[model samples]
Target: MDYSLLSQAPLFKGLTADNIVTILSTVPHRVKKFQSGSMISQSGEPVNSLIVVISGVVKGEMVDYTGRVIKIEDIPAPGALAAAFMFGDRNRFPVNVIAVSDGELLLIEKPDFLKLLMRNDIILVNFMDMISNRSQFLSEKIKFLNFKTIKGKLAHYILQKAGKDKLSLKLDKTQNDLADFFGVARPSVARALREMEEEGYIEAKGKYIKLIDKKGLADLTIE
Candidate 1:
């Protein structure tokens, strides 16, 4: 097993590789690999272990009643999955986790992981801090999802990510990514962008868009 991967995780941050190896020695752990598009964890499934991505990407998604799949967020390498639900009374995966690329994961059963937590206070505190951060992320996501229109969602996302009147080319996302995140169809996002640009709300170039009217965007976000 690669102890270095564990050392990179936030839950194990600040610990030496030797220290991580020592901690793992007390527990029975395993490494699992997933092919691209493989189901790593299913929604509503029992959460029995703390799974950490050793490498590659993972995506969290939820399907609504209408069968529309909403992409939650992407988890990159050295990240822990379902850490916040470990000690919950009804611990379960809230979203389906799928491998975006072939990846390796290290997992420790709850009982064994809890034992390590008991032995190491740093890990325990780090785990709590991670859960707190997850709560804040969920709150922001809820606020973003509350917007009914794709245009509103797009505006809110751009404003939050930009934080200035002008948005740069470094959006770090494609149209399809934006559509998946907004839980809307790809064409819907495409149309919204086209309309926003045509309406003089934003000036769109190949990779950058300048927010021509901050008030116009903000007013649209309220809906």
Candidate 2:
């Protein structure tokens, strides 16, 4: 195992390679290998252990009543899966975790994970920060789901991304990725962007978009 890579994990942030080896030397854990396209954990599955990706990429997604797959997000190497739900009474995976590529996962059982946390102040602090940030992200995701139209969702997304200080910004995700994130067809996202531009709300060319009427964009998010 590469201690250097493990040291780069968020939970091990600020720790030296030696520090990670020293800590893990005393912690009981196991490494599991997974293939590409494998189901890691299904939605509502118990998160009884702390599972960290040692390599490759995985995605969290859910299927709606109509069987539409809504992608929550992708978790790459050194990312901990469901770190937020590793504790709490309702500790369960909220989405299906699927491996995007062959990878190895580091598994630390709950009690051992708790012991590891208690043994190191830095690990404990990092764990808490990770959980808090995920909670805030989920809150924003829920807010996005409330919008009834694809245009409305795009409006809220652009405003939030540009923030209060910037007039021009580049999109971080591609249209295909955005469609997955928005839970809509890729053509719908393209149509919505084209419509928004035609309406004088924004000037978009590829990934670059300039907000022409911030108020107009904001209004679209309201209903």
Candidate 3:
């Protein structure tokens, strides 16, 4: 694999070709393939390394004491870090990372990984930026969960999946997944979805959802 392409990543931006190669060479890089629904990291597992997604999507989720699994976030793009829980003092992963599709990951252990960061200030800054972005996203998620109503949260979540105005995006999520994401019962999610469909804000057929009225969903956004 060409390590230079990895340097193009935000986590390695500004690093020289030589430095990138050196870091990549030092790390015991392995390509791990996981089938869909396979758990890459489970809750309470040791946070030994960082896993970078090279292909496909991964979903982070945590299960409650009642055995309810809550889907936290989705990592859809290549070069996105799959496990941010390894960043600091937390040695055990709090959430489970499951493969949303057949995917490949590049794993780098913590000690050597931190050594690489220490060797390159650019890499260190990039790491800091990634953590900062993750923090901001988590804060927003907290607000969304705590303040927004289920209807409002569902609208925003569907909008994110839709991506563009045309809403030609395919959502491979099930009603159960949507329920977990919104922290509601499956019946509640179904009710909310039905309401949205009735209002002509969205159209859902099987695994595909199209946003028919962006403004309608946008208007549902809570303060």
Candidate 4:
């Protein structure tokens, strides 16, 4: 186990070396590796344990009644708590957590985990902060989905991912994945991307998208 990486996790931030060693001694440690597109947790499944990502990315997505997929959030970094449903009253997961790349994870059973949290105030605060951040992110995503046009939603998404006015992104996702992320049909996303390309707002290659006119895309997000 990489204790250094574990120490860097927000949940363990500010923890002394001795404290981390103590926590590790108390908890049983195991590492599980997963491949891309593998489901870490499925919707409606029992939340028996808490999963911490040791490496790679994971995405939370949900499919609606009409079979339309909506991307809830993307976990781009490590130390992401993938099965947070266990923290609430409902034991079943609400969304599917899928691995976006080949990665490793650590799992701790819910019962023993709660015991650890009960004895540690720092761990409890860290867990609460993680949940609160996720809630805020979901709220923002809901607002993005309410946009009247596919173009508007896509524009908002691109700008949000870019994190800056001028940026480049390796869009490894297929058109279908983009459709799922934007909560629109495949054809709708394709058309919107084409329009953006034509308008010089973006440039798309096989698996790369370059932001050419970020201001134009950002403008679409404004009322």
Candidate 5:
């Protein structure tokens, strides 16, 4: 087996494949495979193990009161799922993690993971740092959720990414995926783009977005 998969997980970072093999010989872990569209982990489920993806992509999502499925984020292989949830008082996952494609996951029990951390000061410190970073990321996600309009969200996102000046759209998301990300309907996103163009706020051709009026976009973000 290519124990190198261990290197991909944040918890097992810096450990060589041989070292990972040695560690795994004593640690309790099991690998599970998921088909595309399968729910890897459910929201409100009793959290126990730390899930590390060895291959493929998974999306963390949740439904709001209005039955809108908001995608929290996407996790590609070699990423740990919900690493921040392992220690907190309310440790349950806030979102459902569903596989976007065929994937393999390594499940390590909390106690076993904790045991590994106990013997390694580096691992413990790295774990804490990971959680701290996750907290900051969640805070940003909350801020993103606060945008009142699709245009406001799009303006905020474009400005935040490529800056508040003239630039091409630097999006890593498809139109449908971007719509899901904004927690809005696809037509709404399309309408917002059309409205922006008609209002002379932006000049967009395909994926390219030239900020015609940066100040106007900024004002819309706040309004």
Candidate 6:
């Protein structure tokens, strides 16, 4: 196993490679390999272990009643899988995790994870920080979901990225990424951007955007 990769994981952020090896020497854990497109975990399944991606990309997705698949987020190497759900009474995966590429995972069973956490203060602090950050992310996601149109979602996203003073900024995510995040088709996002530019609401040249009508964008965000 690559102790360096394990040390880079968010759960072990502050620990060194030597530290990880020393610690894991006392903990029972295993490294598992997965193929691309394989299911890592399904929604509603118990999160009985602390699983961290060691070497690949994975995506979290959900299928609604209409059978439309919505991508939640992508987790690459060193990212923990369902870290927040591990200890809760209703500990279950909120979305199905599917491997985007062949990868390796480090699995530490729940009880063993608890033991590991208890043995290291840095690891415990990292775990708590991860959970708190995830809560804020989910809150923002819910707010975006409340938007009724793709244009509205795009407007809100721009406003949030630009902040209170900035009027020009570059989009951090690509059109395809934005589509997955908005739970809409990629062309829908591209069309919305084109329409917004055509309507004089913004000036877009590739990823760079200059807000032309800030108030108009804000109005779109209003319920």
Q: Which window of ten consecutive residues has the lowest lDDT sum in model 4?
A: 75-84
- How many residue pairs clash in model 4? 0
- Candidate 4: which stretches are off by over 4 Å? 16-18, 82-84, 136-223
lDDT per residue (tens digit) for residues 117-170 in model 3: 788788788888887887887786775586366778877777777666557567
Off by over 4 Å in 5: 26-45, 53-81, 93-105, 121-133, 164-169
TM for every model, in the order presented, reads 0.70, 0.80, 0.58, 0.58, 0.70, 0.82
Error of model 2, residue 100, in angstroms: 5.8
Residue range 101-149, candidate 2, lDDT tens digits: 9999999999998999998999999999899998897787778789989
Whole-model Cα lDDT per candidate?
0.86, 0.92, 0.76, 0.79, 0.83, 0.92
Task: Write model 1 residue lDDT over 171-203, tens digit each, in one string.
Answer: 667989787766678999889999999998887
Predicted candidate 2: what Cα RMSD to the true structure? 3.2
Pairs of colliding residues, candidate 5 = none
Query: 1-223, model 4: which lDDT tens digit per residue?
Result: 6666777778777787678878968986667998999998888888787777877888889999999998877775456655457767787878888999988887878877888889899988888888888788678768777887887887787777788644877665688977875677899888888998999989988667888888788787774
Backbone clash count, each prediction separately: 0, 0, 0, 0, 0, 0
- Residue 148 of model 5, lDDT score: 93
- lDDT winner between 1 and 2, please give it: 2
- Using lDDT as the measure, name the better of candidate 3 and candidate 4: 4
**Candidate 3 Cα deviation (angstroms), residue 206:** 27
**Model with the higher lDDT, candidate 4 or 6:** 6
User: Judged by TM-score, which candidate is best?
Assistant: 6
RMSD of 3: 7.3
